[model samples]
Target chain A: MAAVQSDDPGLTPRSTMSWWFRREARIAPYLYISPFFLLFLVFGVFTVAFTAWVSLHDWHIFDTAAGGGTFVGLDNYARLLNDARFWRSATNTFSILLMSTIPQMLLALVLAELLNDRRLRGPHIFRSGLLIPNITSVVAITIVFQSLFGRHYGLINVALDFIGLDMVNWTSSRIGSHFAIATMVNWQWTGYNTLIFLAAMQSIPSDLIEAARVDGAGRIKRWWKITVPLLRPTILFATVLSVIGNFQLFAQPLLFAPGVGSMGGNDQQFLTILLYLYNMAFRQFQFGYASAIAWMLVLLTAVAALMVYAGVGYLNRRENRSALEVERMRERANARQEAGA
Target chain B: MTNVDAVKAQSAAGPTPGNERQAPTFKPNKRRFSWANNWHYLVLTVALFISVFPFYWMFVVGSNTNADVAQVPPRITPGPNFIENATNAMNAVPFLRSLLNTFIVAGTVTVSAVFFGTLAGFAFAKMQFRGNKALMAFVIATMMIPLQQLGLIPLYMLMDRFGWVGQLRAVIVPALVTGFAVFWMRQVIATSVHDELLEAGRVDGCATFGLFRHVVIPSVRSGAAVLGMFTFLFMWNDFLWPLVVLGGNQDAHTIQIALRNMSQTYYADYALVLAGTFMSLIPLIIVFVIFARQMIAGVMEGAVKG
Candidate 1:
């Protein structure tokens, strides 16, 4: 702001009330936005950087008493890289992420499409009912699911026995454990995504669909051609969100078993990367190596997110570009008619 | 027929013309939507059934003995032992205390995050300031970092130094103002609050803050409400940090930690474990039930784009 102080009493150096007001106006926004930056720096950014530094040291979780940990150069990182357990956890994380997320996205989309009907009146029940699972704490849902997926006497096993089918040991076996954990993740999240997609679908002007209907487009064709194309942004949003959230999958896997220090399983079948970090830091008291694992998680999440963005972005643009071609043809026809006139 | 006769016919069809979803402008025939020929409700029914089944099963198993849950048919009904199991569950772990503690922390975090988010969001959306874009970018960057995981060890030590370990403040302070909250509110403000309104507020010599309080707040009330609901849900369900910092404080645990402790301690006591889990779900279930409509509309606000 320009300082236009004058001989006037309000603007004068002795009584700079008006000048102060102008200055305040100029500076108030920074004041408003500072809280997030301040808190995030102290808590979020600083802590992340601190984790990296800690990874370079020989730090025990409880070694804060006697002048803290010793500075060991790069040993923790080396151990983390060469460790089979870390690789297992990383592989488990990605596998669960894919298994859970792909089915999740498809199911949420299909459910959203079904609920997007204009004739579906007073759907608050369905919408809210679907969201109940999402609202439940991961701890609660994982435990409940673990029960249903129980081996011998569990309800699922009983059902399978009644049908003369083989019952699966959910937690003990690798595929069974991953499937059970994924189901817990899916049940919790699908409803919330449905609402998000419903919102996105609602905004896709109905007349566009009506236009396609009039043009003799089949039901599935119209949906694939028009609705899917318009829903690009929301699809990308949900995909990227799932990438970030499920990649850092911790709570469900942590609480999937019954024991205190279970580590996903005896053989670490369902051990997520974050769960491994927790086990390392808390259970084993290896804070330095745990911090290294944490850094690796950040890198993996970043890579997954970028890949989703690029891949989804390309898919969206490819189809939307076709629509743009049709628009260009129409515009060319209109231009020719105007020239003749 | 006269206009009066037309109105009479409409009234007879439905007691009130207000019952009609849309006014008959272009389409002469007012088509009433029926459930017939629509298989969508079938999909919805199955979906709702799946969604509700887990909780129902939780209730059933929770109200029965471990042996009853193990019965051949698999007990699917709520039993009379719920209150008894609840008492045992409470005694075993700090369920009730954790519920109260979770409420306090989640409530405080929601209020502070919303207020700060609105202030910052309004500034970024409507008001001009130096380094505005840079600061906004910084906030967005913060969202991408799984800072909870990234900063886990350091934060543990930090909380210990501040004498906040085993205290609610350790969990509460770190999450006082989140990046997503700021970004969400900014989207709400940018899309919903119009420039003409802000200009009018400015013409009346309203300060920047006044413009936000008067013009922006009223317009973004629904968005604010939605953000509050989301914030509360996330904070309520937050497990990792609360588990870490408050690990030592068994009595001051959040419901998630309490549930974890209960299920592990009474590992074979499925009834007791499930009872604790069911108790923890009660608050959020109630919130979801009551605010269903508003929450739906709020998600429809389109934070992804706006």
Candidate 2:
């Protein structure tokens, strides 16, 4: 009986050496969750605080010596405000953001609506194919795009020539550079956005479309009225994400330029804010100014997010009010019919 | 059929043709041709072409010589110089070493994220602990702050302090547990794993750690797989962070850094650059092909919840 009891796994007595196992159970959750919090404290929270500290001082990149730099509070910010290159980068960031995001979102929405059709054959194939560009590394993407947009022998220019168009210098011209970079951005992201929008569209009730059709609404009208309104929240979400992502556009423009420089182009046409910050800290070794740029980018992203949030809030409220009005109209009609009876 | 009958019918219907037309519109007609159907196929085909054409072009360019690539109305077909171009690319940089380095970083990060993320996710999903709500909230909030922009300066400084500036661990250690991965795993665990099974494990004398190891981990293996795949892909494609940390340290460079180096070193050598790019992309393409469906589902799930 003793041997049988020992053989039973659950009935086996815990040795004194294994007492820590019982104690460990009580704090197991804490132990489980500690790694994330610990890492985040060091890498995420502390780093931001340190960036703020670094921005206040005139810290050079290699100034590792103790007490090496003097503090000049807000000096970096002040200099940034007056910096022409900084302003140009800011404009370039916004231009690229708008150029890439707007069309990408619209195209994604349309594609999602189309793909939402149940009768569409082999949609899984299309969906998987769409994600190919996204899975490709940005480095590979940039190299391929550089060759495609090359001035002399690029496939794009070659095709343009086939169509009797001039061979536009993709790298030298500002609009041309922005357009090429935006094309890369769109090509990579449009599929991702499509999948997101498709998820949203899938959640929308089929009965709603059937009801609209029964009410004599055309397909387009149903999409515009029922589908688009229902997907407004998702649209807002995707837009905010795109805004945040586009502000930090880096690799495409970095490789798109004629030479391997962070200037983005000869005339600084595609110099995004993040690339600019990278250039300052790594290339120019201005850690303090780069920290300032990082903070400014954070601020810009926050403001953009806030603007979209407010816009979405207002739109939601208006939609609610209009829906309420329609409900009130139905209630009044029912009351009038009862009164007549 | 008379004017009088038509007038009476229109008056009774309250001047609305919708009721009269609703039945035919709402009926399921099997043989009816749909313009919308044709439009959908057309759009999907176009979008698919746009997505896949660049990759196809990469193969074409990579397989051709420089002269062939630079031809007017550039060659659309693959040529016979694929091996030659690939050889030239390998000679230009430490391609295999960089690939190994990238695999190391990505593999370590993926394993760490999966293991640690699963632990935290299981805790958040199942166990009631002190500061759990606040901690989960903190994790979610961390997802909003872009890591590269805010952390680069201080992180670089930290790496310098640690003498790990050019080490693979500099990238791997920091990316071990991402906020998004933790949140995603939590969501997966909360929805999929049940309290009853955990209670059963407890009754069987399974400790908390044992419950997680034996019950929770197995149950959420699919979610962990998704998280691992995404983390691997993100780390493999990562550029800005590695570029900064491993700057000018070609020996420690990842595949992306190597590709960047090749692009510059082989400037105007389109075939070699394309070959390098193609080689760097092959692993991701293979992984994507194998896990395409699961990946699509994972992305959609993340989007919907996130």
Candidate 3:
């Protein structure tokens, strides 16, 4: 890979010395890029693979035997399938996921459309304000939300009392506790998703909207017909991200039901998969079972992502086919007119 | 503001040459006093209020005493017991130690991420090395795999094996480089650093690393600054991994852990809990305010191109 030496009178003697420099230059990029690979391999790839291997054994955190725990292939997986708490955690995770994701996406879409209006002044203020919740630590959010959802003197309870409604114990009932946690999730993430949607909306061609308006389409109709379809890719992307995030929900519920010690509440009402995995590994010292739970979550996240990806792809294909047909029909009309003329 | 300017410039330039005649006929209806015109602003105002109100309420509660906080209407204004409550918050746990520990961890992570992310990003963007494309794809693919979910147990085991289970390095070292940061820096370097500048540097007898130090780093300073800010904020606010790794180790607790500890200890003391919560959030808010534009742009850019 060395370049040919030039015929300059002063360069002839130094050419041999410059060979090392040239070689170094050729390999410098790899040196520069090695840190990340090394770190990722140690912390990321190795850990993931090791966790998989650990899941196949009957390992415990404090199993202080001379050798590693005995091999018990698929026992942890079989146990996970039959565990009622596992099923309960899975249900809680999906329930919270649906509750949080659906409203968050819809509200974010509406908020993004509103903020996309060019006539709005100081839109950045609102946009930045929305991110405040996102930037705050989850521990702080959970603490503040716990006080807000407090049964006795919470501001929410006081507001309910003002409306002649009984104070609901937000931490006791399963649905109530789930709703409380989901509210925090929604509060923290809706603004973030709104900004994402707003970015996607901003990238849409304005001429398309103007054309729809010229055709007498109202504002909402223009959004529904033109903007939404163009934003399908971004929406799908955001949905997949939300699914991955929500399924792995942890700190909010953990802190929300602090006294319960990972049961989430008295009846284990809002025990998310991640929290359950955490309790299993750290609390119960069942490292192998927790690894199994982690793998199951990974599988669930993959399946959710795949389903959304497939659904979006199918819709996009159908839309493209119809659009192609419309173009063909327009071409035929143009050809007919040209022939007649 | 730049986005606004771009939109204005595009509109001022009107449609493409062929479509110029039809552009004026479909000039999007001008501002009118209708629900459509005002409703969006109203909605945005409400959203802004919802977004900011919790922090405001936290501040109010933090400043009040238990008695003042329990009042029916709740103390809407800052009460005079701020110092008392803050002292209680500090006394509840090693709050100051946690803050210092968090800063050390976050600062180290940010510095390392910026340095290494910039280095690797420049290499991937500008250099033609073996397996560059595949390596870059691998980095991007790593972003999709959430580290906490899959790697927690093994990572903990590894840390235990290395005798690092309760140390700040357990959190800081693992976060020293991130896939997102590398991807971000790569995008910025590719767009911002022109090839001619590097060629000029090379012609002037600058070495490869020298060219990177002088040409690439200076060119991508703003991008690096944004990355640094994000890294710091993420490290500061990170919960799960640190929570797992640092578990119950009071000496190694970060600000988040300290805050959780305070809340659990002072579960009955709303004022104390709120004070600790507010204290932990102060740095983030200040950072957010100072770098709001850059942070917003960073998030939007990542979403659009990711």
Global lDDT of each candidate:
0.82, 0.84, 0.84
lDDT of 2 at A245: 88
How far residue B275's Cα lies from its native spot in candidate 1, in Å, is 1.8
Residue B171 shift from truth in candidate 1, angstroms: 0.5
Determine which window of 10 residues in candidate 2 chain A has minimal summed lDDT: A1-10
User: Which has the better lDDT: candidate 1, or candidate 2?
Assistant: 2
Each candidate: RMSD: 7.0, 6.1, 6.3
Worst lDDT run of 10 residues, candidate 2 chain B, spans B28-37
The TM-score obtained for chain B by all candidates, in the order given, is: 0.84, 0.88, 0.87
Best-performing candidate as measured by DockQ: 2
Every model's DockQ: 0.47, 0.54, 0.47
What's the true lDDT of residue A103 in model 2? 97
Docking class of 1: acceptable
Q: How well is each residue in A124-186 modelled by candidate 3, as lDDT tens digits?
A: 899899987988888888999999998888889999998999988888888888888889999
- The better-scoring model by DockQ among 1 and 2 is 2
Worst 10 residues of 1 chain A by lDDT: A1-10
Per-residue alpha-carbon lDDT of candidate 2 for residues A138-180, written as tens digits (9 for 90 to 100)? 8888888888898889989988999999999988888888888
What does candidate 2's lDDT look like per residue over B233-264, in tens digits? 99999999999999668789999999988887
Per-residue error (Å), model 1, residue A3: 20
Error of 2 at B138 (Å): 0.5
